[model samples]
Target: MRAAGLEPLEPYPGSGSPWCCRHEACGREVTPRLGNISSARQGGCRYCAGKAPIPPDEAQALMRAADLEPLEPYATSMTPWRCRCTTCGSEVSPTLMKVRTGGGCRFCASHGFDLTAPARVYVMQHHQHNAVKIGIGGTAGRNERVNHHRRSGWVLARDWHFATGVEAHAVEQAVLRHLHEAGHGPYLNRDVMPNGWTETFGADLVTPATLAAIGTALLSSLPVTLYCSGSSAGR
Candidate 1:
């Protein structure tokens, strides 16, 4: 019995009586007839006595299907495991059931990132395209913004700027309309560009000079608007 897998829990001093042993898989103790090799080797633990535990391979497959990479030793489906979210690349220790139920990253879901703390306007340019990308950065912040673009194969061309998300949006719209009226019409490139910024890609469409002008105009507009709004509220 010792040579076999069963752990002997009692002194068997060669006594021709029933032997007490415990199964390693499940801690259930049982008495087998002395020298009964077959019965002694067939001790089943508590977990094995009921339903079989899920195999590691099957559990890993389930996690991969839900875009989560398992980072813990998988024992059962109910075990709390640490997994990385494929979407935002954030780690979260969610139970197997929670992941199986199509749960996503709470950080992204709740917009709990730095970008969302205060609305941000950002200017980014891609090397493949001539136009600078002016858009609202997601709540993830500037670093995440760069990561997102790089993942999409867009190389950052120039330095980026940040302002209030709302004011940045206004600047974007104003620049777009101004460029369009000057015969740079239909700047929105919905098809090719992944980020969907007002795409003005041409030799003379948008240059460093253009960006400087827009920035200056936006800087002047913000203070005036704030003053006007304050006057109205006071009145």
Candidate 2:
């Protein structure tokens, strides 16, 4: 994997296309597994996992979730559109597609789907709230590219500090500050065996777990630099 993972490519089948896997972002395209911000008919939904077009037999049960009446001739016989997603079915209701900010996945509860909760706030350094950079980079591929981005000043939402994998670790500075202010530092694993990574990759398709393990293992081997020299802000 090239450090930045960005390279000029000869237009080939899969490799030729830009691998876009972000679901909530604008202008992102879809990949086989990573998902992305695309039409509602793609393979999977970034927001709802792979729940659209649930089986037809189950559509009735799913429809009940939104108090939807029986499927109209145009409606899905089953929940979640009953087919990975029927093309532009729009059979599912706006309430069904409604994305509640927080964990209010109530709409899809009967169908066994869970939606993310609202975003939370974090206390960050001046640079964090006001920095000029907004990205992550840690792995040899996208990770490296994100690291390069940090060279420029940037600020990002606190939750982004972990999932972005830009630093190869999920240590959010705000979370770290919370721990440090209490005079406690987080564990940064640096002694993981090679197999640790292999096991991690098995379930790391989500990406955060993979980057987290590698980051902690790397952190464990590094020396700590204490920057708090001012008066101890009593917990």
Candidate 3:
């Protein structure tokens, strides 16, 4: 224990029992099991391991620098700290350690498709495999998603533009669910279409016209704000 930077305060208990000791580096009392230390399962001191309680002022400063305003007192490093995003004004709770490690407010992160932005839902057909795929993508990418499939020999059968990706995604999911309930599932495997197999289905099970109708029906059921613009076929 001494070699591990911990000075035992009591007699050596069994390896399984908790042993109270003072961390020589931080001078903080800690109770750790000898078995854990012997087996290298955990460090002798949580403070030295960066798992101990952090100073509130320092934690707040780190959060502020990340454009997050803390709404609650600082807790453990791994626990979520309720904060309001200064950039998007959206309330979010992100762990302090995650923020320290370069993670920030998820609402402000542009890692995936922006659901609030305009997008398109497309139906594609792969004639050789007799398969069809229904998917959605952001309009900012200029039909790149459909064009990608087109390059893979999956011709674009139809596409509808919506005001938001969220609306288009909802319609796409509804169509997929309807097809699933009709005893149709993915027809292609990863080896066939690595990134898009999950959305592809046997064309015999659902024709392009049927898919377009399903998407239109789903769109009609949505609020007026979620209405889609004109659609195109055989692209």
Candidate 4:
């Protein structure tokens, strides 16, 4: 125990039993089994191992610095901490470790299609499978979602950029609902298009043009607060 930076607080307990010791570095009382410590299976002190109990005030300050207001008292670092996003005013629960590692509010993340950020709704066609797909994604420069499909043998038939992902997603869902009501549900299995098979449909049942038209009609019907722009078709 001395070699491991711990001083025994009492008489020796059996090797398999819990032994009380004080960590010399952090002065924290920890109960660890001698057998486990001797076998190098467990650390001598949780505090020195970075598992110490964090003061509530310190945890709250860390969350506030990340633009999150805690909705409840702080819990374990690994447990979800309920909070409200100062940026988007959305309720979110994120772990302390995740926050410490630089994760922030999901609703305001640029890569996840922030609701108030620009996004795109797309219609894709798979020539080999005679299928079509409808989806929404961020309108960032890369357009990774669409490019991912292109690499998977799906051609972009049409895509429209909207002021926000909320609008784009609304249009995508409206079009998908129309397809589902018209008896054009998912046609591909997970094996073929593992990433987006749930959004795919048989081209014979509904053409890519039809899907694009539905999306366009829905986009036009949305409130004036939402607006969109056209983009060139294909890859």
Candidate 5:
């Protein structure tokens, strides 16, 4: 068996049968039902072969369907690429397979926020526009959350911290609903932002008084754990 390129390892036990053959080429522990190791054909790693390099065109098409335009020349599907994401109009580098699998802007997703952890609700302001966005960032820390938005050309105006994810989500909804009812539709300068779909409101409309009122309403409606007094001063 060793002369035939089969590396014999410990005997593999099966129902009423045992095999004494193993292949190191593919790193498989046991060769299923080997009569004689000599007749067993040597096959290369099946796992690597299954992950064959994907064609550039197919990868491009997959990216296009996900509203992402490749920034670099297309390589293999595994290559990392800088791409323009239409979902948030941000330049992001993600693997071809990730985009193909319906992955979207990382900033918008809060860098895969962990729902099981405490959530931080923030009030972010647009650098060049008179707008503010109220949002939630889960276990993905506040600094990371702000950095993601900043990389996408947004500036963090304020961060409203909450003790739990539930509190933040509830308050965020309250703020959005209040803004939407006020006819701003929870978006300020919506047409100006590139693919802007974040929950935002006009700077003039999102005054300190308005935020206080909305926060108070949320505090009353939600559990006692929901606190709004710890909000950072607006920038």
Candidate 6:
């Protein structure tokens, strides 16, 4: 009938692409595999190597659920996504199409791109309030600095040098001020900033320690950031 739930795959319905014997009509009837639809008439199936008859309507429904409509011509090919790319006019490979969320191909990522600007979020770890370390991910277009780091031997290098004047120090102050105004002080959410989210933001605000606790936190948790402006912030 309609194939035992999941027996025969789509496109190649009705004809199981059988192979057959060709011993000069010795009364043999082996179902040989189906031939290339383009050349089926001359090449035939598995048993007798005959033609792969067109699939009946029952099998068509199965193909439909697989998002493979417009059957009948399926005998020519089995791939579900047999279409041309709208952009480059190239044949979109079926393998690539299968991985996407919807029924579109890889070209879908660029076809209807939204070119508008995206809002940016800056992150840095804030400690007792003296200094901070920054980390950044990708370049936010031409305006933002590219975050990068290089290591030599045991020492690690954190450099956020931008062709544009995106010095991290100034940006750190701005972020600190913004955090201060937001009353988001003494932040315990150091987990959210990630390893090097502030690199693109530029540099940290370093201030002399006013108390032993501040120095201990700064040295021990070298990970946490200083929240105040550098210089005489000891007050």
Query: Which residue runs of candidate 3 sit more than 4 Å off their true CA positions?
Result: 1-109, 224-235
Query: In terms of TM-score, how similar is model 5 to the real structure?
Result: 0.44
Q: Write the per-residue lDDT of candidate 5 for residues 37-126, one digit (tens) a residue.
A: 334442322322335455678778778787788888887664557789878797766677566556755555654655446767776677
| Per-residue C-alpha lDDT of model 2 across residues 47-74, encoded as one tens digit per residue | 2443344443454444444344434422
| Per-residue lDDT of model 1, residues 1-235, tens digit only | 6554568887884535677788665465766555556555433342343334656887787777777788877866545577887878977655565555555454445542332234344445555555555444433335575467667655443332343444444555566556666776534364666445434445356754565466456556553122111101111
Indicate the residue-level lDDT of 149 in model 5.
67
Best by lDDT: 3
The runs of at least 3 residues in candidate 4 whose Cα sits more than 4 Å from the true structure, single-residue gaps closed, are 1-111, 224-228, 231-235
TM-score of candidate 4 versus the correct structure, residues matched by position? 0.52
Output the better candidate (3/5) by lDDT.
3
lDDT of each: 0.54, 0.28, 0.81, 0.80, 0.61, 0.32
Question: What are the RMSD figures for all models against the true structure?
Answer: 19.8, 20.3, 10.6, 10.0, 18.6, 22.5
Model 1 is weakest, by summed lDDT over 10 consecutive residues, at 226-235
Q: What's the count of clashing pairs in each model shown? A: 3, 23, 0, 0, 0, 42
Tell me how far the alpha carbon of residue 41 in candidate 6 is from the true structure, in angstroms, after superposition.
78
Model 2 poorest 10 in a row by lDDT: 195-204
Total colliding residue pairs, candidate 4: 0
lDDT of 5 at 69: 82
For residues 1-235, write the lDDT of model 3, one tens digit per residue: 9988999999999999999999998798999999999999999998666777778998899899999999999987766699999999988777887787777886687765576888888887889999888998877746677777878998777788788876776677778778888888788997889776877888887888888888878776765254444445434
User: What TM-score does each of the candidates earn?
Assistant: 0.37, 0.16, 0.52, 0.52, 0.44, 0.16
Worst 10 residues of 6 by lDDT: 147-156
